[model samples]
Target chain A: MRIRRNLAGWMVIALVLVTMPALSAQSGKVTILGTWGGHELAAFEKVLEPFEAATGIDVQFTGTRDLPAVLTTRVAAGNPPDMAALPNPGQMLELAAGGHLVDLSQILDMDQLREDFAPVWLEMGSYDGKLVAIVLSADLKSLVWYNPKEFAARGYQVPTTWDELLALTEQIARDGHTAWSIGLESGAASGWPGTDWIEDIMLRTAGPEVYDQWVNHDIPWTHPAVRRAFEIFGEIARNPRYVYGGTTAVLSTNFGDAVNPLFTDPPRAFLHRQASFITSFITENNPGVVAGEDYDFFPLPAIDPQWGVPALGAADLIGVFRDTPETRALIRYLVTPGAQAIWVSELGKLSANRRVTPNAYPDELTRKMAQTLVEAEVFRFDGSDLMPPAVGSGAFWEGVLMYVGGEDLDTVLEFIEAAADDAYTSGAATD
Target chain B: MEREGASPLVHLVIILTCLVWILPTLGLLVSSVRPAHDVAATGWWTVLRNPFDLTQYTLQNYREVLGAAGMGRAFVNSLIITIPATLLTIGIAAFAAFAFAWFQFPGRDALFLVVVGLLVVPLQMTLIPILRLYSRLGLAGTFVGIWLAHVGYGLPFAIYLLRNFFGSLPADLFESAFIDGASPLTAFFRLALPLSVPALASLGIFQFLWVWNDLLVGLIYLGGSPSVAPLTVRLSTLVGSYGQSWHLLTAAAFVSMAVPMAVFFALQRYFVRGILAGAVKG
Candidate 1:
């Protein structure tokens, strides 16, 4: 009788402990952290609504730009949110390295992803060839946006090659308009626009093999190919008529504000080269100008046709934290075509899945943008973003400024190469 | 006649200085009231050009900031931390300064020297060891944790200033108080504190500002949860890779400033009096 009572008490205690998790975790709410503004948040809410209504999961969205800080602190405190939307690939890797992220391999199908993305983007979100982050959308940087009305009035044709581009720039100058409106100044990360210009030109001038070697740190920064790219950039940037504010414009003008003058009456600039995301800022500020009719884009002209202008883009990564059954469902939901359809329809975003047809783009420019994204044969994530912030937001941007501010190309390249080496090496040290 | 000629120039200089100082603040205030889209499209000063277009203005930014999770909680937390901190610091520093200035003891000058010397050590150098000590004491992430840390950090400057004012006190009054059989504590309360009001007021304002605007120490020791964080920590979250959300930022900044401004206005008379008293007494 005594033994049986003791056994019964132990069984009761074990059952209570086992059932406690079920009781505490009864509420099926999944929390997500993301940026506060734009169509992105609006879209996310729309996508999650159906899921929430179906499963009775209450979605608590924490809108914040500092997702990394919140995610890091919460994970350390052992109360991480279910999912987090990260803009930078490097941060996803950092979280993975710290043993904080859940292994998403079994949950996500990596083989079905678009093969056009730069290999580094693939590696940035992968640990030991196991996928950790699901890439949702991309922002392409190798397109030259221009006022179609102005181009038509001027009887201008889109340049097909580098020689034509330079000739066309001179022609546009003769036609009494700025050929390029380059603004790179973004404080702390001030020189990224210039870096994008360089990367775009390099893709047009230098082939993917050489680009890959440079990205992987195999090619020397002072290589002839690199020097040639800077010199070409300098020629256009330094030419007073080619850019609105000339070389100095790249330093003082805010990158977002650079496109403002281009939309002025008589068109301050005939050509403005920037990523697709800039369309929103442009169209928002300029009320009447239609995107597809008033303005159009052509891929940055090939310096040499063999190189093929590679698209410079960035991806938003969603990494899983806790591998509960619900978390797996969320991850699987995110990587699916249906999930992407909801994002595209609601968010006005470029989808990572080529199969999802984007219907709810904000404007004709974004419609063209959607088509361009789907048709892209090669896409590379922002190289600087792949680097640590100290380098990505620091020395890399500074090097671009130094070059624009009249530092010799060879010297800036050498410094950047050494800086990159030191940064990655030190990054290893911290880990 | 000589003073008359100088008055115009002095007024001109003062006006120019005020204009220069106030323009940016005015712009920030104006920007805070304008719609986010409008702010992005034009300069903040454009509103003054068309002040009657009230349709362009919006309280959406402030509404968003206030509605954010834990903002009210943070405001309450800041008050809880700052009020007691200011009072405790003034109370303790005033007492210590009175003793240091009036009493004669072994190492009297040397002890004063040591207290003053602490002012020179950089606060950053001591943060790590103190943080480690805090962890050992199980004080991290609690209100009491940050309060104690702030008290420790704020003491040297507080003690130094009060001691200077206390030292400047009229010794004859203290002697007279003693002769009347007033205890040291009674003499301090009756004679020292009353005369030292100017110093106390200035110190209170200075400490309040420091404790209010502080970010690093607060972030490190208190942890960056919305539940416990001050406005500075919340403001930092507005900055991310794309760029600062300037609309939200301006509103948040002004919201944080409202308290300090109110505190300053409420205490300005006392602050001015404190300075005047210090000058006269010294």
Candidate 2:
């Protein structure tokens, strides 16, 4: 019954995504499938408008997460959309390996792309040493959101180190206020925010190299570093004084709603850790609150301090399924600063291309986020998103939820380890 | 009326069952008017906390849904797909059922058994092959494509239902019609067709609703072409993969549900009689 409340919210989202069709009415057409909706889709249309005008190529955008499934079905039926923007690299690699994707290297100028994109950004879209997709948009996940005006009222200082963050939590509790407003409930994606926490903690506590090892399952889940990451999350998540409505609320509150308390009058809670997308949700839900005045974010503090600051985030990579002169022209335009400037300026999204000037981002905070991505010595993609779905989206998500639900840390890790072993060993990741 | 002593208990049970069935629909009706955030933050029951406050209500959701482009066309498209599919399935299946029921022929029982066996074949297993066939025949994304799919899928049960109903008719009626200088066709038209209205009505209702509500068949065959997609295909786009904005879904769902609810209520009596007809004999 409790879960149904959250499900109702998601059901509305699933039901309401039906929108306008971007049908191409002219010659030189490219059909692209993606999963964007509402504001995001509006912004994307703005991005494509300029490209369409410049190239005189009509781009038809069909939005759905059903891309892979639909693509598979259509391919079996001997039909597929021209290109698709995948949520992760796994599917891109799947299509590429299956020979369903056109190799970008053969048509586009790779040296130019390599010069424009960060090595990691380039790496995200590559499979079997060949570039299969191009990373277009990225969002930073390393920030912990809080209201700066409230921080000023409380005489709190931003913490750059892990010890100071812990002390601030104690100080907030001592002031008779909750320090954190943690909510992981997101319907089919309920435990994802919790997964982000574990990933961030892993990045901070065990360093990026070990984080990679853990994500790839080269190291077992029972390893000390992974366990320590989960335990460190427990310090805030498991503690009743640190969190707003206790552990049950963490399980019950929608992650979008998690930061709502931080915006209330006098502020009910002081902190929420979420990706860049949470900013829109914050402003959309509580219209009166100003970003820098009512809320601002600082990167999650360094755990070991010896490890340079880390940012965990995800990106959308586009892969072409049908090759044509028009499709090739679209791909070439996408990797440029001019094309991305239209999207970044409109949507407050950061570009993976280094060629895009910092000023292209809409706001001061976004400019700073793009700067953080540029300066960070260690950055990792969301760990769970990188692993096979059976473990990453599946067991790892459930593992974190179970741990937050007061299950034994060892038992939860062991459960995740069991899934990871099967998922990795069976080569589901490759598939 | 039959159980006089248990009437109070029966009434109590009936009331409870009605409450169970009606509450979700009531909640949906209440939610359709409330602001998206208000609906998300508080349960629909919270409106009853005051039950009198009208301050938070709005018709914004409905205005947006009805005013959207192609919604009117989508409603028209659903009718075009559904009406033909329903009528064709019923017309074709009625003949096949009549033949299986009245005529004595070679492998007649085996043929009836074969039709019965078709019910076990899942719709999903046949989709790809059917789509391939449709594509080769140049029928995909056409109204005929979806109509043919719905009819094919709706047939096994339709034939089974009509055959059972047809077999239950009296042997003497057909014999008397035959003795009176009636050909088999004349006998079928005169005796069988008019008497099977209840059965036909029920089958019509079932096939109509099934075809109307289907999303997979419409999406696959029609392939997002505006010229032929039904309401579900249009309504599905209201949601992106992330389920970003869902308030529209509640309104769209109610909009689509209205026609079917009307159809059901109009045809309910016949449907009940048809389902009950010859059920006891089996």
Fnat, model by model in order, equals 0.03, 0.21
lDDT of 2 at A154: 84
Q: Please report, in order, the local distance difference test score of every candidate based on alpha carbons.
A: 0.72, 0.82
RMSD of 1: 9.1
lDDT of 2 by residue, A1-431 (tens): 44347557644542332211222233687877777755676777788887888888877666655565665676677666688888777767767778888878898798898898878888888887888899888889988999998899889999888899999999999999989999988787679899999999898888888888887787888889999989999999999999999999999998878888887777889989998888777776676667677778898888887786888988888999888999999998888888788878876778988889888988888898888878888778888887877888889889989999999999998898888877885432222
Stretches of model 2 off by over 4 angstroms after superposition: A1-28, A53-57, A425-431, B1-6, B106-122, B132-139, B181-190, B225-227
Model 1 alpha-carbon drift over 4 Å, by segment: A1-85, A98-100, A106-122, A287-296, A320-347, A354-357, A360-364, A388-390, A424-431, B1-10, B33-153, B172-192, B214-241, B273-281
- Put down candidate 2 lDDT per residue, B101-145, tens digits, no spaces: 899999999989989999999997877888888878867766767
Where does the lowest 10-residue lDDT sum fall in candidate 2 chain A? A15-24
lDDT of 1 by residue, A70-175 (tens): 5565555555567777877877888788887887767666566535334555565788667778776666777888877777777888888878889999998897
- Per-residue lDDT for A59 in model 2? 79
